[model samples]
Structures are given as structure tokens and as C-alpha cells.
Target: MRLLLVEDDPMIGEAVLELLRGERYAVDWVRDGDMADTALRSTAYDLVLLDLGLPRRDGLDVLRALRARRDRTPVLIATARDAVAQRVQGLDAGADDYVLKPYALDELLARIRALLRRAAGRAEPVYEHQGVSIDTVTREVRVHGQPVVLSAREWAVLEALLARPGRVLSRAQLEDKLYAWKDGISSNAVEVYIHGLRKKLGNELIQNVRGVGYLVPPA
Candidate 1:
């Protein structure tokens, strides 16, 4: 998944960025609301982690602007603000969820997973089709009841294809999900990862549409 992290505190931003990246998410971090608003306008993200205290513009304004543009991307507000009114206002302004500043990283990850699950219209973390099964939480893949190992990039590609099952995801879309702003992606990076996934998972798992990119046929 690709995520936008809007945090002003260096310690918090650095920690969250590393954590999300380690979880195999493509994360773009901005330290202020202005930059966050620009990113929201320019790119498509799977989710957004936003902090209420920001520079240049208020975080609440950012959220309102995002909603004003009719962007339905999920937003999770993480801030030091703990007032009941603040939490209610954030929800009223269109945040999908909220977490306090000193929250557990494990719980934060859990909330992220839950939001992703809801966005995908799925309740289960394990995704299964035919003989292949993948546990999103465990990062485990099994084929025909046998464990299979996949590289991080390969796993990312497979997960992207599985995210919407029958819907085709263009190479550009997949690339967006696999890389952040600083990462250099090869011209054939998506192809390479897709090839790796096919070889390890199954030849017929990801279907190519010749000109339309790829998809996992509906089960």
C-alpha cells in the first residue's frame, strides 16, 4: 500500500516513516500541511496518516480541503490533541479514525490494517483464491497447502494484483504502490516484480490484458 504521512515532529515522522516502510508500504512523508495538501492533489494514496498540528496551514483545513475536492481517501488522524471536542471535530471534518500521540506502534499498525481492510470491502486479512492463500498480517503465502517464500518486491506486486481481484491495475498504478518519492524505479521494475511473482506463485495467477496492464481473475 502507498501512504501519505503528514507529521511535523521530526522524531514522530521519522519513526512512523521507517515503520510503514518496513511493513512494505510505500510512504511519502511531508512535515507540513501545505506539502500534504499538494501531495493529496497530485498523487493517489492508499491511505493518509495526518497530524493535527502543522505549519503553513492547519491540519484541519487540510482535511477539509481534501474533502472539498471530493477525495474519499481514508485519513487517520494521529496527533497530541486529546480533547473530546477535537476528536469529534476531526471525525466531523472527515477523518476515518484517530489515534493519540503516545499510542502503541502495534495498535497503530492494527488500525491501519483495519482501515485498509474496510477500504477493500473485505473483513478477513487472509486472501485466498484457487490454491493460493496469503495472510496479509503475517506476510505469509501458501500454495496448495505448501509454504512459499517471496521477496518483498514480488510480494508487493502480488498483493497489488490481489487487492482488487478482477480489476486491472496499470503498470503506473502498481508502480505508485511500490515506490516512494526517493526510490528510483527501473523502467522494467514492475515487469520484473510481476515476473517474479508469476514464477513463484503460479503462471496463471496474474493475468495480463496485453494493453491494459494486469489483474487476478475473479475467483
Candidate 2:
């Protein structure tokens, strides 16, 4: 899963990044609210970790802007202030959850998991599609009840395709979803991953629409 982390403090940002990456989450970290806004608007992220004290713009502004635009991506506010009024304000401003400073890494992770689960509208983290099953939270995949190992990029490609079954996802769209802006995309990277998936899963699972893109089941 992908998450956006908006934090200005280097130490805290690094700590959070390490923890989330350890859990197999692809996270994009930004130092200011403006960058956070840009990333949130451009990227399809599962959740966001927002810091109230941000540069360029206040965190509340970022939260309000996203909500005003009808972006339903879940956001968890991380702030040093733990006052009831502040918490209420953050929640009212569209934060899905709040984590106070000096919190345990475990607690932060738990909150992130909860927000993602709520955003996905499911308590279970597994996504089942016929003979294939994917644990979105754990980044684990199984084919026909057996484990199927996939590289990070392969898993990302699979995730994007599985997210919208039956829809013909263009190579550009898949590229946007699978890789971050900083990561350079190859010309036939999407095709390569698709071929790999077909070889592993089954040729009948994904279909090419001639000159267009690819389509998965829900057919």
C-alpha cells in the first residue's frame, strides 16, 4: 500500500519512514504543506500522515483543502499538541485519526492500519480474486492456496490492476499508479510486468484490448 507522510522534522520523518517501510508500505515524504498538497492531489495514496505544524501552509489548511475537493483519502494527524480542542479541530477539519507526539511506533502503525482498513471499507485486509488472494496490508499474495512470490514492482503492478477489475487500464495509468514520480519508468515496463503476471497466474486472467490497454476479470 502507498501512503503520504507530510512532516518537516527530519528525525521524526526518518523514524516514521523507516517504520512504515519496514511494514512494506511505499511512503512519500514531504517537508512542507505545499508539497503535501501536491503529492496528495497527484498521487493515489491509501492514507496520509499529516503534521499540524508544517511549513508553507498549516496542516489544517491541507486537510480542509483535500476535504473540500472531495478527496476521501484517509488522513491521520500527528501533532505535539494533545489538547481536546486541538483534537476536535483536527477531526472536524477532516482528519480520520490523530497521533500525539512521543507516541510509540506501534501505536502509529496501528492507527495507519485502522485508517487504511476504514478507507478500503473492509475489516479484512485480504483481497480475493478467484484462485488468487492478496493481502493488501501485508503485501502477500497466494495463487491457488499456495504462496506466490513477487518482486516489489510486480506486486505494485498487480495491486493497481486488481484495484479496478474489468477496467482497461492504460499503460500510462498503470505506470502512474505503480511508480512514484521520482522513479523513472521504462518504455515497456508495464508490458514486462503484465507478461510476468500472466506467466505466473494464467494467461486467461488478463486480456489485452488490441491497441488499447489491459483488462482483468469482472468480465
Estimated TM-score per prediction? Answer: 0.98, 0.86
Q: Deviation in angstroms for 156 in model 1?
A: 1.4
Output the number of the lDDT-best candidate. Answer: 1
Worst 10 residues of 2 by lDDT: 174-183
Model 1, residue 127: displacement in angstroms? 0.6
For residues 1-219, could you state the per-residue lDDT of candidate 1 as single tens digits?
899999999998899999998998999999999999999999999999999999999999999999999999999999999999999999999999999989999999999998998898889999898789889899999999899998887888888778779999999999998999999999999999888888888889998999989999998
Q: Between which residue pairs do clashes occur in model 2? A: none
Task: Show model 1 residue runs off by greater than 4 Å.
Answer: none
What does candidate 2's lDDT look like per residue over 25-124, in tens digits?
A: 7778999999999988888787899999999999999999999999999999999978999999999999899999989998898888777767645577
Model 1 clashing residue pairs (backbone): none
